[model samples]
Structures are given as structure tokens and as C-alpha cells.
Target: MKTIHLGVFEVAGPQVGGTLSWPHPRSRSAQFHDLDHWVHIAQVLDRAGFDFLFFADGYGYPSVAGDLPETAARGGINFPSLDPAVLIPALARETERLGFVVTSSTGLDHPVQTARRFASLDHFTRGRVGWNIVTGASQNTVAELFGHTTMQAHDARYDQADEYLDLALRLWQTSWDDDAVRADAAAGVYADRSGLHRVEFAGEHFRSSGYFTVDPSPQRVPVLFQAGTSGRGREYAARNAECVFVQGTTVAHTAANVADIRAQAAQQGRDPASVRIMVGLTVTVRPTHDEAARLRAEFEEMQTDETVATLYAGNTGIDLLALDPERSLEQLLDRDDRGPVGQMGQSNIDRFLPKDGSAAPTVRQILDDLKGKGTRGFQVWGDPVEVADELEHLMDAVDLDGFLIEPIFDPADLEDVAELLVPELRRRGRMPQEPVAASTLRERLIGADGYFRRPEPAAASAHREP
Candidate 1:
């Protein structure tokens, strides 16, 4: 049987699942700025044998609903977000085993800088770093932060990302030879000059001509993670990502995504099994089924309709406030007056739409469905054994590698999973009872065999001595 991997999903902000999550009495999100809060969570996950701590990030607040930022501000929806890159090293220092995956947009940062930053992080974490590649999905992100009057066309953004990744890969994989650094005290020499090569790359979106400043860390390159589920996105990920993050509203939807990604990977000359598929999963576990149900109900009650609308608007770039609540999604799609569907929005429709594409869910119904549910991932609630059973069933049904656990409340929600659910999973032999340490994040996630190995430099040809 294939071993299952587990990771915790988090964001450096006031709320994770929904707008009202931060205000809950048990929520520790208010301490987001405090290093101790992050350290405690990191330590908890590390001790629980989690494979990694995945941090989702964004550049701008959601403003798609009525083109007003006040809704997001009032609801505290993804506002006050901090850069995850700055926090990763601190978290890495606090935990010995947990890996860190930070989001960086291919559309925003230059490839060279991105390559250098992650390379440094790889060294700092001793190879416990991964990059979650995103093509800036929100128009607000491009307009407010990138100074673009309009968001790049969806396919165009992916086209740019394709080149961006190609340039980054060359910098990480080809710039330094394995034997580049040779410290010799007698000769007072630090590096073998011939072993270092300058990467000269020219692409439609990027150009770089330099050697990588940082030497190769334990992993050479951080594990690549891609969450895009569009046709272009899937192709890009299949060619590059070692781990793919996917979200779906149902089991069939998610399983289909997994199969598509694996098949695409095979087409790219990569072993389909070499790429791991992690589906998003939200859980509310208590000692008894009744207690769990009550907790879920309480969380749901905290959600407001406006908050849900604002959150969805921010994601899909469709102004929910402007649309009639009674209008069906099918009707909205038919109307040309509706604005362009953002990349994230398009992905959401693909995941949540009825299998036959005939159901017409109204705006009110959509918001009602999303209310109290913190994320798009599948939700599970019950006692430890029941939760484990659900997870195992999903795994068997979907062929998922593992799950990215979405936390409703910072440490408290995670605490329940660690204390209650984890033991149940261990008992079933679905997860390891003890934590296993690996030298690099790639080794931990996919093992050494799956890691990309750099080819050794060829020896100089023999010649007659002059």
C-alpha cells in the first residue's frame, strides 16, 4: 500500500476558513504577528508527524463584490495578510521535521529573484522548502500591486508563467555543478571556477545571464507545487510540479482532477506516480459525534451571507452584489454582460458545477452553500474513528496521496486533529505512528528516488602533453 502524507494549510492573516473565524474565542489568529504563535503551531504539526506546513498567500484584499474594499475590511476577509517567505525561516528554525511551502506568484516576481530567494530558504531550512507557484489570479492583485490597468488574459498569464518557470529551472538546475565548491585551506581556494556556469536564458517574459549566487542546497531545487486546475495550468504543472494541489466540491470532481494531472504527467515523460496529488480537506473532530456536529453547526452560524458573497466575489472576480440573488449560475454564464471570469473563478466553476452542467444554482443558494464552510475542500466531521474512516474511504475512492488539512481555528482546531484524529489514523495503519526525518523536503514527500538528480559534469578529453 502507498503511504499517506499529511500537511496543514494556513495563512498569515486573521482568518483562514471564513470571515468570522478570527473573532472566535478559541482563535489564536490575533497573534499572527507574534513569532511565538507561529512557532507553537509549527512545533505542534512537526510533533504530529505532518509532512509540511503549507501557507496560502495573496497580494491584495478581495474587492470584486461591488468594487468596494469595505466588505472585506469589515469582515476581516484575508486582510492584514503578511508575507509567508519572511515567516518560513522562523518556522523552520522551530521545527526539525516540518517542511514549508510558501506561495509566490510567477506573474509578480522576477524569475532570478524567486530562484535566489527559494535557494536561500532551502539552505536555511536544510532543504525543507517548497514553492507554491501561482499565476496571479485576481485582477485586484494585478491592478493594485503590479500596476496593471487590467489583469493579463488567463491563458496569457500561463504563457508568461511557462517561460518564468523555464528560466527559474535553468538557474536552479544548470547554474552550479555538484563539485563547484571545494574548500582547500592549503591552496586558499574556496570554489572550483570551472564548475560554475553562467545561465543565459532569454524568454518572452524573462531574461537572465548570471551564475546562481547561492550554492546548491541539500535538495538543489525546492519541491515544486502547483494548484492551477485549468487546461493550461494542468499542462504547466504536469511538466514541472512534483506535487499538485487540487480543490473540488465532491469526490468524483476531485478524483477526475487527480487522474487528469497524472495522465498529463505521463505525457510529459514523467512517471505518473512520481507526481503526488494532495486534495484539500477540512475536518471538525470531537470525542463524540454529537459534539462534533454541534461544533460544525456553531462554525456555520458564524458566517454571514454578505461575507460569503464578498469572499466568492474576491475569488472569481464576479461582483455578487451586482447580480440578482435569484439568478441561476447557468443564467449568469449565459449573460455576456457578466464580467470576465477570473482564473480562480473559472477553476471554481469547473469544480462545483453539476456533473451534467444542467443544474442552475442561484446566487443565494451558492452563498448559502458556502456559508460557515471555511474553504472549497471536502469537509469531514465526527469522532476520531469516524473521521479516520471517512478519510480512508475518500483515499480509497479517489486515489489521493494525502490531504492538506484546513484549520478552522489556529492551534485549537489543529490540536483536535493531532490529539484525536491522528491516533485513529495510526491505528488503522494509514499514517505512520512515528515521525520520520529526511534530509530534504523532496525526500520526505516523494523519497530520494523521486528527487531530480543533476547530471555529473563530463571529464575533459585526454590530449598529448605540450
Candidate 2:
């Protein structure tokens, strides 16, 4: 049986799922700016035998509500964010086994800088690093932060990302030969110059002509993660990603996504199993089922219609405030006849629209749905055993490799999972009996055969006898 892999999801800001979470009495989100807070969480998760800590990031505050930053800032909706790359080294130093996955955008960052950062982080973490590649999703972010006068069309962004990954892969894989470094003090040689090669790449979106400066880290390349679900996005992931993050409102929806992505991988001449699918999950657990229900009720009460609207606007680039809440979504879609507009627009549509393509829901219905569940993925509210059972059921039903646990609030939500949930999972033999012995993140997540294998140098292959 496959050991169910686990990871914790977070953002380097006060809020995670929605704005209301930050103000909860038990929440320590206010301490997000403090280094000790992150270090403590890292240690806690490391002790709990988590596979990784996945940090989601964004470039700008939410603005789709009024095309202004005030709503996001006033609500503290994903504002006051910090760069995950800056936090990784500190967390890495505090933990030995837990991996770290940082979200970086292909649209805003240069491949050279991104390659060097992840390469250095892989070394610092002893091969426990993964990169979540995002094509910048927010139009406000594109205009205000990345200095783009206009957002690129959805498919065009993926086309640029294709070139971005091509350059990054060349830098990671071919720039430094496996045996490039020879630190011999007596010979006074730090590196063999002949083993290093320069990469000259010129594409429609990016151009670079240089050798990578960092030596190969333990994994050589950080484990590649992608969360895009559009046709172009899936194609890119199928060709390049080692892991894919997906969110769905139901088991069948998630399962179908997994099947589609795997088929895409096979079509790209890659092993479908090599790419692990991690579903998003949220849990609110207590010692008893009744108590858990009470907590869920309280959480639901804290949510508001405005928070739901702002989140929707931020994600889809569609201002829900301007639309009549009483009208059906199909009516609005037909009247405007506008397709998905942002990078994440299609995904947001998929999340909100009914699977059967029947009559569309009203704006009020959508908000009510979000209030009940907040966002996608499996949501469980129960005692530890019940939570574990729900997780197991979802894993089996969807054929998922793992879950990225979304915290209702930082530290508190995660602490509950570590203390209450993990033990139950272990008791059921759903978790590993011992810590994974693999030295690298890729191996730990998908076993030894799941890592990237570079082609052998021609000279080295020729020297070996048949």
C-alpha cells in the first residue's frame, strides 16, 4: 500500500483561506512577521512527519472589487505578504526532514535568478526544496507589480512559461556537468573548467547566454510543482512538472482532473506515475464530533458576503459587486459573453459552475455555497478518527498521491492536525511506520524511481563498453 503523503499549506500573511481567519482568537496569524513563529511551525511539522510545508504567494493585494487596493488592505485579504524564498533558509535551518515548497511566478521572475535561488535553497535544505510554478494570475499584480502595461492573454502566458522552463531546465541540468567540482587542496583546483558548459538560449519571451554559477545541489534541480489546470497549463505541467496541485469541490471532479493530467503526461511521452497529484484539503477536528460541529458553526458564522465577493473577484477578475446578486450566473455569462479573463479565471469558473451544466446559480447561491465550505477540496469536521476516515476515503476515491492541508488559521489549525489527526492516521496504518529515508524531496514524495533522470553525456556513454 502506498503511504499517504502529507503537507501543510500556508501563506506568509495574516490570512489563508479567507480574511476572517486572521481575527480568530486562537489564530497566531498576527505573528506571521516574526521569524520565531515560522521556526516554531517548521519544527512542529517536522516532528509530525510532514512531507513538506507549501507556501502560497502573490505579488499584489486584491483589487478586482473596485480596481483599487483598499478592500484587500482594509480586510487584510492577503495583504502584508512576504517572499517565501526569503523565509525558506530560516525554516530549513530549524528542521532536518521537512521539505519546503515556495510558489514563484514564471511571468514576473527571470529564469536565471529563479534557478540560482532554488539551487542555493536545495543546498541549504539538503535537497528538500520544491518550486510551485505559477503563471501570474492577477491583472492588478501584472500592472502594478510586474510592470506590465497589460496582462498577457491566458494562453500566451503559458507559451512564455514554456520558454521559461526550457531555459531553467537547461541551466539546472546541462550548465554544470555532474562531476564538475573537484575541490582538491593539494592540486589547488576548486573546479575542473572543462566540465562546466555555457548555455545560450534565445526564445520569444526570454534570452540568456551564461553558465549557471551554483554547483549542483543534492537533487540537482528542485522538485518541479505546477498548479495550472487550463489546457495550455496542463500541457506544460505534463511535459515539465514533477508534482501537480489541484483543487476541486467534489471527489469526482478531483478524480477526473487527476485522470486528465495523467493522460496528458502519457501523451507527452512521460511516465504518468512520475507526476504526483496533491489535492487540497481542509479539516476542523476536535476530541468529539459535537465539539467539532460547534467549531465549524462558529467559523461559518464569522464569514461574510463581502469577504466571499472580494475573494471571488481576486481569483476570477470578475467584479461580483457590480452584478445583481439575484440574477443567475448563466444570465450574466450570456449577457456579457465574456470568457475567463485572468490566469486563474478558468479554474475559478470550474470551481463555481455546476458539473451538469444545468441552470446556473445566482450570486447569492454562490456566496452561500462558499460560506458553507469556503473553497474547494475535501472538508472534514469531526473527531480525529472521523477526520482520518474522511481523508482515507477521499484518498481512495480520488486515487490521490497526497494532500496539501489548508489551514483555517496558522499554527492552531496545523497544531490540531499534528496532535490530533496524525496519530489516528498512524494507528490505522495509513501513514508510514518510520520516517522516509530518502535523501531528496522527490524521492521522499514519490519513491526512488520518481525523480528526474538526465541523459548520460555522450563521451561517458561511449567510454563504457557494451
Stretch of 10 with least lDDT, candidate 2: 457-466
Q: What is the Cα-based lDDT of residue 417 in candidate 2?
A: 89
357 Cα displacement, candidate 1 (Å)? 4.2
The C-alpha RMSD of each candidate to the native structure, in angstroms, is 3.9, 3.6
Query: lDDT tens digits, residues 37-90, model 2?
Result: 999999988988999999888775566633645656776776778877899988
User: Scored by CA lDDT, what does every candidate get?
Assistant: 0.79, 0.78
lDDT of 1 by residue, 230-340 (tens): 778888888889999887577877787788889988887788998888888888999999999988888787888778877777777766556788876655667765655
| Candidate 2 colliding pairs | none
The TM-score values for the models, in the order shown, are 0.94, 0.93
- Give the worst 10-residue stretch by lDDT in candidate 1: 457-466
Q: In model 1, which regions exceed 4 Å deviation?
A: 334-337, 352-357, 450-466
Candidate 1 to truth, TM? 0.94
Task: Score candidate 1 by lDDT.
Answer: 0.79
